[model samples]
Target chain A: MIKDIMLISELGELALIEKIRGYFSIGDSGVLIAIGDDAAVFSADKKNIVTTSDLMSEGVHFDYTYTTFYQVGFRLVISNVSDIYAMGAVPSYLFLNMALTGKRSEEEFDDFLKGVREACEHYNAKVLGGDLSLSIKGDFYSATLIGFADRVKTRSGAKPGHNIFITGNTGDSAAGLAYLKYVKKRIPMEKNMEYTSREIDGTILDTVRRHLIPCACNPETFIDKIKAMIDISDGLLLDLYRICAESRAGALIYRDNIPVSDGVRAIASMLEMDYMDFVLSGGEDYELIITSDSDHLDDCILIGKIIKDGFFFVDSDGIREKFVPKGYTHF
Target chain B: MIKDIMLISELGELALIEKIRGYFSIGDSGVLIAIGDDAAVFSADKKNIVTTSDLMSEGVHFDYTYTTFYQVGFRLVISNVSDIYAMGAVPSYLFLNMALTGKRSEEEFDDFLKGVREACEHYNAKVLGGDLSLSIKGDFYSATLIGFADRVKTRSGAKPGHNIFITGNTGDSAAGLAYLKYVKKRIPMEKNMEYTSREIDGTILDTVRRHLIPCACNPETFIDKIKAMIDISDGLLLDLYRICAESRAGALIYRDNIPVSDGVRAIASMLEMDYMDFVLSGGEDYELIITSDSDHLDDCILIGKIIKDGFFFVDSDGIREKFVPKGYTHF
Candidate 1:
C-alpha cells in the first residue's frame, strides 16, 4: 500500500518562524536598524525617534491556559514599553493591532482595553490608534511603540573602559517563570497570585515585579554625559557585549558585585542552577545599562554603577583578573 | 483516553496573524481594517495626523515563498507608503522594527538595505529609527508610518446627494489571484506558461494586479475641497457606507457608471457573479472614494460626489432609495 505524508500543524510557531526567516535578505542598509534588539532603529533626526513592535500569539506568547485577561493585557503593554525604555527614551504613544477568535465577551475586551489604558497612564504615554481584525483561530496581539529622544543608546555603544550601570536588578522574570511552572505542576489549586504576589527570597519575586512593571526614565532627566545606552533585555552579558561589538570594545567586571535578588538566588539554588548565570545571561531584564564619561562618574554613581571595566576582584587581598561576557542569543 | 490540543506554530503564519487580530479591541471606531486592507483607519481629526502600522512577521509576512529578497525589502517600504496614501496623507517618514531569526549573511543584508534605499527614493520619504529584536520563534518585521495632512478621507464621508467616483478601474488584483491559482494548478505540464501570462478578456486578473501593486495619488494634491476620502480597500459599496456614516451623509452611485476592467468582467461573468457587484463589493481596489464641495465638481470628477443626507443612490428615472451597507468586515 502506498501512503502520502502530510505536513502537520505541530511544527510549532518558532519552527514556522525559522522557515519564514529564510526569505529575507538583510541589505547593508537593509536595517539601518536590524532585528533582535529592544526596538528596531532607523535614522530620523530633528528629534531622534525610537520604534519597537511585538506580536503576542494567543497560545504561544501567552496562554489563556495560565495567563489571566488582565495579566495578558499588562504583559502586552509592558513588553513594548520596555523597548522604548531600553533605548533610553520616554515612551510617548503606542499603536495596537489585534485579532480575535470565537465569541469574546464584552467584558474580556473591556479588560483588555483597561490594561492598555492603565499601562499608558502609568508610563505617561497614550494609546494613539491601531488596527483590529477577526481571526478563525485564537486571539493574537501586536503593538508598536514610538518614543522620542535627542540621542539614542544602542547596544554597541559601550567603550573599552566605561563602567556598565543597570537601573535595577535582573533575572526576576526567569525566576517568575520557574515559579509559574512549579505552580502549574501542582494544579487544581489555582490562585491569582500575579497582582499581589507574596514576597519570596532568593527567587526574584521582586525582580519579577520589576519585569512586570519596569520603570521608564525620561531621557531628559540626564540629557548629557550618557555616552552610550542600551536596555537590558537579552541579559546583561549579551546586551553589553552587543554594545561592545557596536562600539568595538571589551569589558571587565566583578561577579561578586553583580546584583541578585534573594528569591532568584533561592530559586536558582532549588533548581540547582548557577545564580550568577541567571544574573549574567537571563533575558527580559528590561533595565537600562549605560556607559558614561569618567568625568561623569557622578552620573554613574547617581545611576548605580557598581563594576568598572578594568576591575580586579579582591578576596582576602588575593586580587584576580576576570572578564564577564554572558548575553542571550536566539539561535 | 487523553486528547492533545493544538499549538500555534503548527498553524502557520496566516493562522497566527488571524489569531493576533482576534485579540484587538477596535472599539466603536467605524471601519474594521484587517487582513486585506492596505491600512486601517479610526475616527480622528481630518486635519490632524493619520497613523497606520504594517507588521511584517519574519516568516509569515515575508516568506522565502515565491518572492525576492529585495522585493521583500522594497515591498515592506512600499506597503506603508500605500497606507499613508490610502488615508489621504502625504507620507513623510517611517518607524520600523524587525526581529531576526538568525545571523544574516552580510551580502544578503546589504541587498535588503539596497531595496529599502531604492524604495525611500521612490516614495520621497525618510526612514525614521526603529527597534530590532531576535525572535524566539522567527524573524519579525513591523513598521509604523506617520503622515501629515489637511483632511483625512474616510470611508464614511459620502452623503446622499454625492456622486460616487473611483480613481481607477477595479478587479486587477482579483484577476491576478485567479491567474496565479490557475497557473499553479497547471504546473509541471504547462510550466512554460508561468513565465509569460497574457491579459485575459475578463478575469479577476486585473483586480489581482491592482491588489498586488496599487497606484496612489498624492492626497495633498486635493487637500482643500476634499471633504471626505477613503482608499478603496474593501469594495466600493461597503467603503462608501463608511464615508456616509462618518459625514452623516449618503451616496448615489450610478451602478453602470462604476469602473470595471474587461478582464474582471470576463472572469466575473463566468463565475456567474454580477460585474457591478464585483465593482461594488469586490475589494482590494486602491482607488480613492471621495466627497467634495459640489462647487468643485470639476476637481472631484476624478472619482465620486457629495450628496445630501439619506438619498444615497438614484436611478435614471430620478427615483432614490437606501442602499444596504456592504463593504468588508473582519469579525
Candidate 2:
C-alpha cells in the first residue's frame, strides 16, 4: 500500500490553515485572541502602533531558480519586520496572506511555515491571523506587521547639516545576486539548480545568506540619537533621495566613504563590474540609512551630510558631481 | 493633436502611488504619520487593537465581466471592515497592497481609488500606507485593517442554550449573482459583456448592489449583548458550523426562520433554482451572525439555538434532521 501525498488543494482552506497554525503557539502575553478569531486581538500597551505591509509575488519579486521555499518565507518576515524597526518599533504581531498555486506538496508548506515560525521567534513576535486563497497564476505572499513604539520616527524629521549614517555594509546583496548568476553560468552541474547553502564555498555562502536573510537594526537602542531614517530597500542613493525629498532637503555624499564589504568588492572585480554601482544602485540591502546631528554612533558609519539645496557626490579626487538617482522600480 | 493615454506601466510604482495618494486625506486624529513613510503610525487609544487582512485576485476571486473596478475596490474594503466589525471593533486605519498588471488606464486606476476613498469616508477610516508592484498575472489586491475595540469578540465564546441571530438578509448576494448570469445568457448584445447597474431591472439591480457594495454591522454599538459573532462570508450553514466547532458546541437551526429577501426569492424563481440552496450554501453575504441569550436585538432576527451535542435542523413540519455543513472553500 502506498501513502498518498497531500496537496494544499486536498486539505482545503480551513484545514490547511489549521495545519499551518499548528506550528505557531500563542505564548505572547499581549495576544488576547489569535488564529481562529475573525480578527486577532492584542493589547496595545505602547503610546503608538506602527503598522507596515508588503507583498511578494512569484515571477515578479522572486524566482524559484535562486530561492528556496524556506528562504521565501523567511525573507517575507524580514521585509515586514525591517519596516517596523525603521519606524523605531519592536514588532509584536504578524498577519500573513498567501495565495498558493497547488503545485507545492504538504512538506513544502510545512517547511515554509517552519521558517516563518523561526523568524517570529527570533523577533519575539507572534503569528496572529491571516487569510489563504488559491491562485490561478502562481504563489503570492503578503505580510502585515504591527508593532509598538514610544517615540515614532518619520521620514520628514531630518534637517539640513545633519550627518547621514548607514548601519552595516551596503551592496553585499547585489554582489550576492551577481555571484549567483556567475556561478550558474560557470558551473554546469545539475546540483547548482537548487543553490543550497552547502553546495557553495564559505565566502560565497556568507554573501548569499546576507542576500537571503538580512538583519534589521533594533531602533529601541538608537531611537533618541537618530533624527530620520529609512530602510535601504531600493539602494542607498534612491532611499537617500526619498529622505531628502520628504524632509525638504538635499544631500552631499562622499563616494569613498560608502561602505562596501571585501566579499562584495572581490565578487564585483571577478565579474568585471564596477563595485560602486552595486553600492549606489543595487537594492535589497535592508540596512537603515539614518540622519542625525552626531556622527559617531554604535554600528553606524557616516557617509554623507544633509544639505539645504542640491544633491551631489564628492569623488575620491575631491571633485563634486551631480548625483543621478537610479534604483529598482516595480514598473 | 492626439493625447496619449496614461498606463500604470508608464508612471512606475512611486508615481502611481502618488496619484492614488492624492485621492485620500489624513483626517483621522489617530493617524500620526501616513503614506510616504516606511510604516504608518496611529494612536491606539482602546485597550486592544483588532487586525484583519484579506486578499482578492482578479480571476480567482472576481472577474471584470460582471463587476466594475469601483465595485472591486469597494468590496475589498467591505470584506476587511466586516471582519473587524465581527470582532466588535471600529476600523480606523487601512493599508492596501495592489499588484497592477500595467494594462489598466490611469482613469480606471483613479476610479478604483475613488471607490476606496468613498468607502473609507463612509466608514470613517483612513488610508495610511501601502505598496504597489507590477503583476505578471492579472491583478491582486490585499487589505490590512487595524482598528480598536473595548471588548474583543471571538467564535469560542458561544455557550449552549444561546440564541443564534443574524443581521441583514441572507442569500441576496448569491441570488444577485444568479440573476447577473441569467441576464448575460439572455441578452445577445455585446454590451452584455459588461454588466452595469443600469442594464438590469430594479429588482435585480437591488440584489446586485447588495452583492457589490455590502454593509457591515457596527458591533461596537451592541458588543455587550453578543456572546459570539462571526461574519457570514462562507454562507449561513458553513459559518454556523465554524462557530459550533470553535465553541465546542452544536446548533439547531429552524429551516423556516432563516432570513431570505423577497428579491432573492424572485430571482430564484426566475432562474428556476432552489432559494434554500442559495441561503444555505452560497457565500459572500458579509452579514454578522450573533449568538446571545436574549433574542430581542435591534437589527437581528433570531434563527437558531445553540445545542450541547449534535448539529441538526428543524423543518416547518417539526421534524428534526441531521445538518450537513456546506459552503464555499477556496481549495
Candidate 3:
C-alpha cells in the first residue's frame, strides 16, 4: 500500500508554520516569545552566550537517496550543538532556516520536523523561531544554536605538555558510509519500510546508525580541567592541526592509541580500505578533542600530547612521522 | 573592456575565508572570540539577548537579473536587523551562512561581502563567524543577527484603544520593483558596470534605492511605551493583521493616513495601477508597524487605532470597508 503525502504549498505558509509550531512545546521558563512573533525572546541568565550557525545544502552536504529527511534534520541539530559542547557550553536555543524546492511531500517535511523536535528535546533546547523560503534547486537547512557557559573553552589555550584526549570512538561514520556503498545495491527494496528499519547486516547497521546519529560530547562536566577543545567535523588530523595553529603549539598523536570500533574495522576490511585512513581523516565524527593537564583524564581516551612546534604521529614501530593536514573543504 | 571574473574554486576555501576576514575590524570590546573558532563567543552584558535569523535564496527571495550582488547582501542585513529593531533591541553581532554554487566570480562575491560589511558598520554590529558550503544551484545567504535589549516588545501585548504607528514610508519597494520591470527592457547593457550605477530616471532612482537599502527603524527610544510591534516585510495590511491575530485585537486603519511616496504614486499612475494596492500588500519594505499608547507618539506617523474585534479601513469619504489580509508567501 502506498502512503499518502501532502505538499507544503497546499497548507499555505501560515498553516505550515502553525503545523511546525505544533511539533514543539515551548513552556520553557526562559523562552519569552517563541513562534508567531517578529523575533523570539529569551533571557540570557547572566552567562556568556556562544553562537554558531551551519548550512547544509543538497548535493553539497548530503545526498537524499541514501539518507532520510529525519536524519537530515537530526544531524543538523547534532552538528550545531556539537560546536556548543566543544566550548563547554550548554545549548539552550535553536533558530532553524529551511529553503525548500516545493517538491517535498508533507510527510517528508513532517518527519524532518519531528527529527528536529526530538533532537531539541534530547539536548534540553527550544526552537525559538526561523524563516522558511522556497528554493529553486533543492532543500537547504541552516541551523543557528545559542548556548551559555560561565567559563568557555576556546582553541587558543592549549599549551605544550598538555595531554590530548578524545571522547568516544572515531572512524565509525566513514565506515558507515563505506558499508552503505557496499550493500546498497544488494538490499531488497521495500517501499513502506523506513531506512532505519530495513533489514541489514548487524555489524554494518551499527556503523550506519553511528553515521546517522553521531553523538556530541558534553565537556561541561570537566570543563575546568580542559585547556582547549574542538569538535571533530573535518577529521581528526585537520581539527588537531587547527588547535595547534590557533594555540601556537603542536601535537604528537599515538597511532595505536586512537579509538576505532570493531564494526568500523570490519566494514573497512569488507570494503578493502585502510581503517586507519578513516580513523585519522574521516569527517563528521562529531566527537570532542580536548587538550588538558594529565591530572584530568577521567572519561576520555588519551591519544596524544601537545608539543612545542610540529605535528607528528608516533607509529607502532616507535618512529615519529611528520603529519600533513588534509580534510574536507566546502569549496 | 570586459573585466576579469574569478571563480570560487580558484581561490579555495581557506584563502576565501582569509579574504573575507580582512573586510571587517573586530576590536569591539564585547567580542570575546570572533572568527577562526568552532563558534563565536560574545558578552551578553547581563541584558536579554534577542536573536533572529532569516534566509534569502536566489530565484526565490531575489534575482540577479534586476538586482546587484551588493544590493542582495545589503538588503539581507537590513531585513535581519529590522527584526532585531522590531523587538526594540540593538543589533550587535552577525553570523552569516552562504551556500555557493562554485560558479560565482571573485569580484561579485567581494561586492556582496562589501555590502554586508557596510551594513554591519551602519548598525554597529560585528560579524563574528559563519559557515560556507557548496550549493548545487544558485547562492543562498542565511544570516543570524544577535541583539541586546533591556525590555522587549512582543506581538501579544496590543490592546484595544492603542494607536497604530509606522516608521518611514511604505510601497516604495514594490513601486521600485515595478519600475525596474518597466525599464529593464529599454536599458542598454554596459559591460563591467554595476546595475546601481546604470542610468535611470531620477524619480524612480530614489525608490529603487529605497528598495535596495531599506532602512530599519530603531524603536529603543520609545520601547517602553510600545505595546506591540512587527516589521513590515509582508505589506501593511497583512502585517497589521498579524499583530491583530497575535494580540487578539482588530485594527482600524485610515486609508489616507497610510504613507505612500511621490515616486510610488507617479509610477502607479504611469503603470495604471492603484498606489494603495502596493502600499497595502507590498513586501520587503523593512519598516516597522507599531502599536503604542497615544502618549508615546514620537518621531512616527500615526496611521490607525487598535479595535476590539474586526479589521476595517476607513476611506477618505468616511466609508468603513472590511480589510481582507493578503500578502507575500513562500509557497
lDDT tens string, model 3, B1-331? 9755453334433343344244223443354434332123344655666778889999888777787777788888888899888877788777788887666655566567767777877887766656767788778999998887666677767999999999878888888888777776322122223445445666776777777666777887677778888898878887888889878899999888887888889889989999888889988888888898864567889998999999898988989999788776666
Model 2 lDDT per residue over A1-331, tens place: 9755543333433343343244234343344434331123344654566778889988777666776666777778888888888877788767777777746555456556656666777787666656767677878889888877766676777899899998888888888878866665222122113444556666666676677666666756677998988887778898888788778999999988887888788888888999888888888888898999986878788898999978899888889999777776675
TM-score of structure candidate 3: 0.83
Stretches off by above 4 angstroms in model 2 are A1-46, A181-199, B1-46, B181-199
Listed in order, each prediction's TM-score against the native is 0.74, 0.82, 0.83
Question: What C-alpha lDDT, on a 0 to 100 scale, does residue B173 get in candidate 3?
Answer: 89
Candidate with maximal DockQ: 3
Q: Provide the clashing-pair count of each candidate structure.
A: 107, 0, 1
lDDT accuracy of residue A118 in candidate 3:
70
Ranking by DockQ: 3, 1, 2
**Residue range A102-198, candidate 1, lDDT tens digits:** 3655456656666666676677665655655554445666787776655666666556556656666667666665565555521111123444334
The candidate that achieves the highest lDDT relative to the unseen native structure: 3
Q: Give the 10-residue window scoring lowest on summed lDDT in candidate 1 chain A.
A: A185-194
Better structure of 1 and 3 per TM-score = 3
Instruction: In angstroms, give how far residue A221 of model 2 lies from its true place.
Output: 3.5
Q: Deviation in angstroms for B279 in model 2?
A: 0.4
Q: Which stretches of candidate 3 lie over 4 Å from their true place?
A: A1-46, A181-199, B1-46, B182-199
